[model samples]
Target: MSKKTVELSFPKLVLIIATTVFSFTSMSNAFYLMSYAAMPWYIVAGLLFFVPYALIVSEFTGNLGQYSGGLYSWIDHSLSQKAAFLTTFLWYSSYTIWLASLFMKLWIPLSILSFGQDLTTRTASFWHIPQIYWLGLGSCILVLIVVFLINKGFFTISRFMLLGGSLIALLFVVMAVSNLILLVNHHGQLSQPMQQHILLNSPNRDYQGLLGNLGFFIFGITAFGGLDTVASLVDRVGHNKRRFPFAILIAAILITVTYLAGIFLWGASANWAAIFTNQKVSLGNAMYFLMFNLGHQLGGVLGLSSAGTLILSQIFLRLTGLVLFWAYIGLIMTIAYAPLKSIITGTPKNFWPHFLTKENKQGIASHAVLGQGLLIIGLIWLVVFSNAHAVNLYNNLTLMTNVSRSIPYLIVAIAFIQFRKQQHDYQLIAPRYANLASGLVITTILSAISFSIILPLFKAHYLESMLLLIGPMIFSIIAVILYHHFNRQIELS
Candidate 1:
């Protein structure tokens, strides 16, 4: 008799892929980035970009069935090899810069955990240097550890993603409850409708400010992607056609709700100006502070001793800090592994040089891992040592990462259009014209938004802006040049 098939349930599949795709931390950060103004944009982007993008991916994955390299595979099959290389390069670089941002963010939880501060301090001593420097140092250590683990073949991406995703889900619940307590304390009620706070009063209509918000909008869009990372595992799901779409739809809804909750809770006590005061605190750090205070409040309410409140809050805060740090490591690990594997595995042999093609005994891409790690380390150093203020530097990196990351999505849309055009035998999931039209419209809108955001950098930020705009393109160009050169050499030899 044939062995009974074992399949992952829809819920289990969602757990595996959710963290690798959407991050609550990023969604919450974007919530605070645009303050209440993010609400309308979220709705707008959700309809115009997010939902359509997900549909496009689902259609592509369904049609491509059992052939998976995620984005790289999708593009490579539909477009020229050079286009595939460039798309994958931009995709990979997006996460790499994002890794730098996360590295710098390590100090946030550390300062909160060790020093009990809401605002990240630049002055505290760690090995005789500033506290921020230690954070940078810690980031370097994390990169080294990740490289070592991947090279040693001890690393697993989905396990970390599942663990981290589960904790983030728990964190959301904790945050909601704690924020409720704080809300009751301040407002004398817990039943106030959150929708009232959704629309900002006198929203900023200026071009430059709106342009900056475009970056945050793009960040929100990024929170919805990378779901296709789990395409290879689609067949393992019990019902791919029914389950996968339901899972992603539910994930999108949950993310949207969480963003609203966070924005309303925080905005209940502070104006947009106050919320935007420091890019350093971040939504996660703010949640820590709320948790700390809520611990004390709950202890008193529960009739625990005064000392118990202090101890409980301290313990809770420390635990939160540790969990957050570990989650960052998990996320960066997945980021480091996923795109690199996708790009290399999907590309032709001659496209990448032998050095990058080398793998360890366990099939881990050792050389590629090292190269990615070194790039991240250099990026961290540049940001940490830059003359720009920490907040500006971090924000700029985020915007750059958002821009780079969205490029692949745009390419994916274009590729879908091309694929549908070339394959007349393909059954229509939706109408081909509707799909193609929406994809083009979404890509064009996103491009316009990105261009508007990058335009002012030429005048205001000058050099930093230039790097942010040109850096990924330059890297992609270099990759293309090397690919051609290698092909030429092979032909001669």
Candidate 2:
């Protein structure tokens, strides 16, 4: 450690890590989980999956903080390089699924901005073909443009991310204040009153079963999935050995509280009965719909005319759309190349095609980005065109995303246990009991994955459940294929 090396203060590290966790999380997850498991499942998942995973990541911070490749660097050092590649491959693939899904979801906000409500179903198709396929094709074209324009980069993205972060903060604050007012003005009456029994059980009858909507609980866990992104920043923290891990632990707890509060605050305005009875609110447009209702109800609480309330609702809806569109456009581009770059640069040059590995003065690998973008477009076509219904496609994509994202954590958790044992001593957490913290997290995630797979079968979503089980198998097969291909290339070279 050099005295000249600049280091972040504890408070600054907390702020940075908190922002990272929040960036990884989503208000939409709160609404999705609220529809089923609500707060109880949130608490359970937070303790078992969320916090312990943070502990595992924090353990990585002190050891692998010097490396910038995040999970790839950490796992490569602690485990085999091939093991690292496989872990990051799963992570990148999960995120790519999310990227492909966003093409369809971006329509939700576009619909809200154009009309007063979601019109995704109408816009999903034109000339008897899904528009998402067209957008996916367009996305591939844009990636080629990006490949050509990589050096002169289109525009700086920091400003977009800053603006997006601000909008998210404001969105939560506005919701919290409006819901708080409603709670008081309504004389301590909740629109959806919480009963002890209902809080612990699945609230939506459609999702109720012995396993109790395990998918949503896993969805809640997915919100905690991006600790690796935060792990990348440990190098900047002042006391890398101590402060960074503590900051992550603190950020994890704070994020859990925020999500739990957001879920609870929603009940002040959104009645579960009304939303459930009206089966129209699928997972697709639920957030926009709920936020629109929040604005409308808040306008009513302010003693506005029906017309004024409608106008306010429309304004709010459009604003949500604009912000989401702005945020995700930049975010998608960021994730698209960022993860690919990490994976490509972290490994030996022969592991990828030379053209793909070749970087110009701009530090851009054009072919690799194009290759990934082409793959994403293909996946988008398969998912968007395969689903018969717009809502069902979005639901499948979102759930598939949950399963995709969850596997990375399972890989890391199991790896972290091994990573920590090689350490002479543990810092903030003990490694004895075979690193029990990660063990608990690993068990919880595997259970969620297992139950999420088998339970949905009884409900007759046979294909969806089947995918949840086989999704990892598919990813693992791809990882194996890539590994062998690269290994053969190395041998020949």
Top-scoring candidate (lDDT): 2
Runs of candidate 1 exceeding 4 Å displacement: 1-9, 30-36, 118-121, 124-137, 152-155, 179-198, 202-216, 228-250, 261-284, 289-316, 381-402, 422-428, 432-437, 440-448, 451-459, 462-468
Give the per-residue Cα lDDT of candidate 1 at 348.
Answer: 66
For model 1, residues 1-493, the per-residue Cα lDDT tens digits are: 0011125566756665555565655555554455566667667666777666666666666665444355777787788877877888787777777877777776666666776664564467856777666667778888888888756542255456567777776766676666566566666443223445435432333312645556555555655666655553343343553466556666656655666666666543344454345555555665565456557766665577989889877876776776676677667666777677777766766556778877667566688889889988988777666657855766665655555666677778788777776653334355645466456546654665456457657459676566657665666787688668867876776
What is the Å distance of residue 80 in model 2 from its true position?
1.3
lDDT of each: 0.63, 0.67
**lDDT at 329, model 1:** 67
Which residues of candidate 2, in runs, are more than 4 Å off? Answer: 1-37, 123-159, 229-247, 381-404, 424-426, 460-462
Cα RMSD, each candidate: 5.2, 4.6
Report the lDDT of model 2 for residue 487.
Answer: 90
Candidate 2 structure lDDT: 0.67
TM-score of 1: 0.78
